[model samples]
Target: MLGAIYLSQEINPHNVMVNQETKVEQEGQHFFLRSKKDFDLYPTEIRIQLGGCEYFILLNGRIDDREHLFQKLSLDANKSVSDTYLIGMLYQKFDLEFVNFLDGDFAFSIWDKQKNRLILAKDPIGIKNLFYSVDSGSVIWSSAIRNILHIVPNQKVNSAYIKSFLLDHPIANESTAYENIYRLESGEFLVCENGHIKKDYYYQFKIPSITYRKEEDYFQHFNQLFERSVHNRLRTPDNRVSIPLSGGVDSSSIIAMAENINKKDNWKYNIATYSIVFDEKEADERKYIKSMLEKYNLKSTVVYGDEDWNFKIDFNVLKELDEPYPLFNRALASKTLSAAKRDNISVVLTGHGGDHILHADLNYLGELLKKGKIINYIKDLKQWKNKYPLHQILKQNTLDPIFRKTRLEYPSWLKKERFADMDLSTILTKRFEELKWDSKTITAYFNTIIRQTGHEWFDQYLSNPIGVERRYPFLDVKLMEFLAAVPPTLKIRPANNKYIIRESLKAYLPIEIYGRTTKGNHSFLITKGFKEEWNRITEYYDFKILTELGFVNGEEIKEYCERWYMGYRYDLYNASGIMRALALEIWLSDKQDII
Candidate 1:
């Protein structure tokens, strides 16, 4: 884990003092002390100025030293501390109030020595993680719980939170898997001064005023915005970039764009593409991935899974993750990341946010159609009706008018009811109860779904070659803002979901891939594989563990496992019930005094 620490003392401590004369004369004044782990990426440096002092600390990765840009931004060279250009610019340009100007997956702390204040911030998406604690006279922060626990005494697990974990698979935002340590939520900032801590939210996805426009105009704007996002992510040079290609539009589009950029710039760098191939026919998409790789002449690696690989779930590898995330395709991703780390790849690109924003699901399309803006409604209806049967179109349109009129008229109870069927109570902890049901909750749920899935996948990426960055071009803030502004009809049309996205990429992608109907091919394969191996997986973990923990009804779980062995989809749901139960059981085991 990467971590940074800052200490402000009345005088420079002997351990941190830089000058021998100051130590002998006892003239060490108020100074800043910074310590960082994995400092090969950042060397120790000190700068002093006429006005104040600044201490720079770096960890985890190579420092990008574009000095001209730093000067252009008016960074204080004499007393400046910055690990990344983005972080430096934020502090220099906006100081403690700079949270709104940044839009990257980063967490940083700025110690304004002159003002005797400390500023800490986290990314909008909570991608890069940071946690801190402020005591009466001291403040400490770390990238991992262990780091903080090492320095601070009397660290003990919170038993009540552990009890909650036993009941729910993961703890809520207010609680951590451990006690007394709190994670700064995504888009949050904390300022510490004189032992008082004030936390504030700095960023959130703002739904834009819908503009009714020509469909082509929206499509063009989306294409340009998406391309720019991809370009920004690819700006770092000489890094061996890997794309988690799934042969779907999201990952495939990223691969195609990277290839296009490589060709245009005459870049010699090889883009390493990785995809998982399972023994199960449905799970294996290697053939399609191979087709794309050959079509583009891109260098690729296919990680084929065997039976043994299916049973490999190392909870210890991802112990840092605060909760028990549903380990679906991420198991494969973890294996791939290990392989990539072995190959010395530092950054892996993924198409995580594409589905939530650009490639929205049919449900979002339905919401748009319900709005009944006559021209858009008719346009979408014609396109959808043509692709689907006449009766289906009529039925959908019939339902649309009701939702359109009642969309904003939803009572709190009805909004809860709308999401109840999705089993959010089971997925989200009681924190869902405190949250008001509104567009923010809806957006949070949506973003939570993406972040949970992405972070689970990213767990593997982080395990190897410590500090390997996993970049998501699709989650770019500008692209999301643009998508929020565009009319929903353009985002998801009747003929195909993400119709505009596909149309925009017509020239860049293969026709077969562009016109593909399967939204995600991984789930089917995962379910099929789980069914095939149900017996082994069930028996591997003692059924009594789940029963004794009071997380699941033991007899019911055993019966479901038996039914799953007999080949039934009804049993699959039962298996999911057991899976959730077992996950909670495992989560409880990690807590102090629970077992």
Candidate 2:
């Protein structure tokens, strides 16, 4: 929760006026920082002068390797230490290159007065957020988009961003919902100095070119990295922490690992678990959840999906997020966060990002075919066909990427003319060609780094108001790097995904989770909520703003909804499209009024 404005020497600093408390109002300076005094966060707003260079740092999250960073940088351990100072020392030693050695969930900005340079960087995995808008050689940035809006009140909506959001298509990684405002993406940094601005990635996905001697070596290394990731995130003020435990392998395995570390280190703390259970048998995981709770001897607070099935619009939430969020799981996520807050929990670990990095798909099959490894491709495809139909395997791994047919289904309700000028098909096709890695690795990398960053930031934004910080052990940079290098065969067997985890944590996890094949589906909750609220939801079916803007056909949307309400079950993509449309319509009308 930090916001600031930095002006290059060419711009007038005196023209700026920020409506924030705890202001840094220094005379004859070109920058001012104002941080929200919530969450009792550490290392608040450090300003220091070293070697004729004045520096200002604003950090939203904690640094895990503070002691190591201090010792390596030759800073006195006994001296008063703060995360901000440690970062400043890193900058002193390595300049902007200091980002490589950092580890934690953080989004920070550093200002160098002597060089008139400003740098903004987010953590490698994007657990935190930093959004900025540049105009006339000046920059405005904040941890929250609403805060940035507060300063630039008359910002225009980005129609391109809206189109991509509604259509569920890929857009520029830096694009935000606002025209000028842009998000500094995960693993990236932006620098502005001397009336010039440049953005570049400090980190990129790389696979190590080494071979392991044995299969057990891979499992052992994965467990070590996984344990270190869990250990680092357990740094809280009190020894109390909580987890959003689903009965799936990811969450269950985290609970198992945490317990292992707890007993091994003899560091006992109160661990709370919160879960969203469903009445629908297909979506229910209470049986497995109970096993995890009983086995780990941990208690879980439950939030039932059937009990909290209202999809009402909250203007406050919309205002806070300042984006079009998926409507399907919002209520469930909010309820779980509320339950955690009610129990006085501030940090909640989650199993998000596991599927992207851990589960392997058939993308490598297409790669093998193209590389002339026909025998290997046939063998793998035959194995996969045992679990799925041949047509599906071929379409997903080969035909889809080549023909660009697996992108978002263009619902018949939308205006086709609006999309004609965008050349979305070419963009989608080019997306695959731009990355030269194996198909499996490329898909995993994009999902984990590019796509998931937005989701991670949204989760962070959603939990901010409730005073909860969500940490993801699966999203750790080191762990992801190691997993990236792992061969696709190790991750995806004939009948199993996440083969590495299933093999590595067999002893630690319960039999139910380790050997489980099916994962919980949220489509049940989506359908249930929509059915119960059809009448209320259809009130906005008019879509006056959207229809008037030539994005959708009102009558067509109504027909689609009526069909669903009358007993037709649309596929997951089509059903989710309706929810996405509703969310966008609300934001289009409400956000304009709010801002």
lDDT (0 to 1) per candidate: 0.54, 0.73
Model 1 C-alpha lDDT per residue in residues 1-595, reported as the tens digit of each score: 3232234344233443332221111122233334443312232332223223442322222222335445645666665544454454545556676566565556666555555556667766665556665443456565555555655545565544444433334422445555666777667888866546788888765656646457777777777877777765664446467788777888889988888877877875567888766666656666667667877877667676644333246544333444444453445656566666667776678887787666443333344444545675566667666677867655544454334332221111112332332333434422322322235444565455434434522433344226456777877766776665565456566556777778878788777788777643334433444566665556534545544533344665556556545555543423433555555444445453533
Ten contiguous residues minimizing lDDT sum, candidate 1:
406-415
Task: Give lDDT for model 2.
Answer: 0.73
Residue 427, candidate 1: Cα error in Å is: 7.2
Count clashing residue pairs per candidate.
0, 0
Candidate 1 residue spans exceeding 4 A from truth: 1-51, 55-86, 135-137, 152-174, 210-212, 306-309, 314-323, 326-331, 359-372, 385-446, 449-451, 454-457, 460-467, 519-551, 565-580, 590-595
Tens digit of per-residue lDDT, candidate 2, span 1-595: 5545544455554455554433343333357776664522444655777776778778888787777887888877777767777788888889988998898888888877667678898887677778898776558888777777766666788888787766653333688888888988877999887767899989765665546979899999999999989888877777677888889999988888888888987867667888888887878999899989888888888888765553644534543456666544556777777887888877788887787677556666666767788898888887888888899878777555444543434678889888766655433322232333474435445444545434554554567767777888988878887887777788878766799998999898878888888988766555556577787677677888889889898887777667666656665457656667876776676655533
User: 54, model 2: CA deviation in Å?
Assistant: 3.7
Model 1 clash number: 0
TM-score for each model = 0.76, 0.88
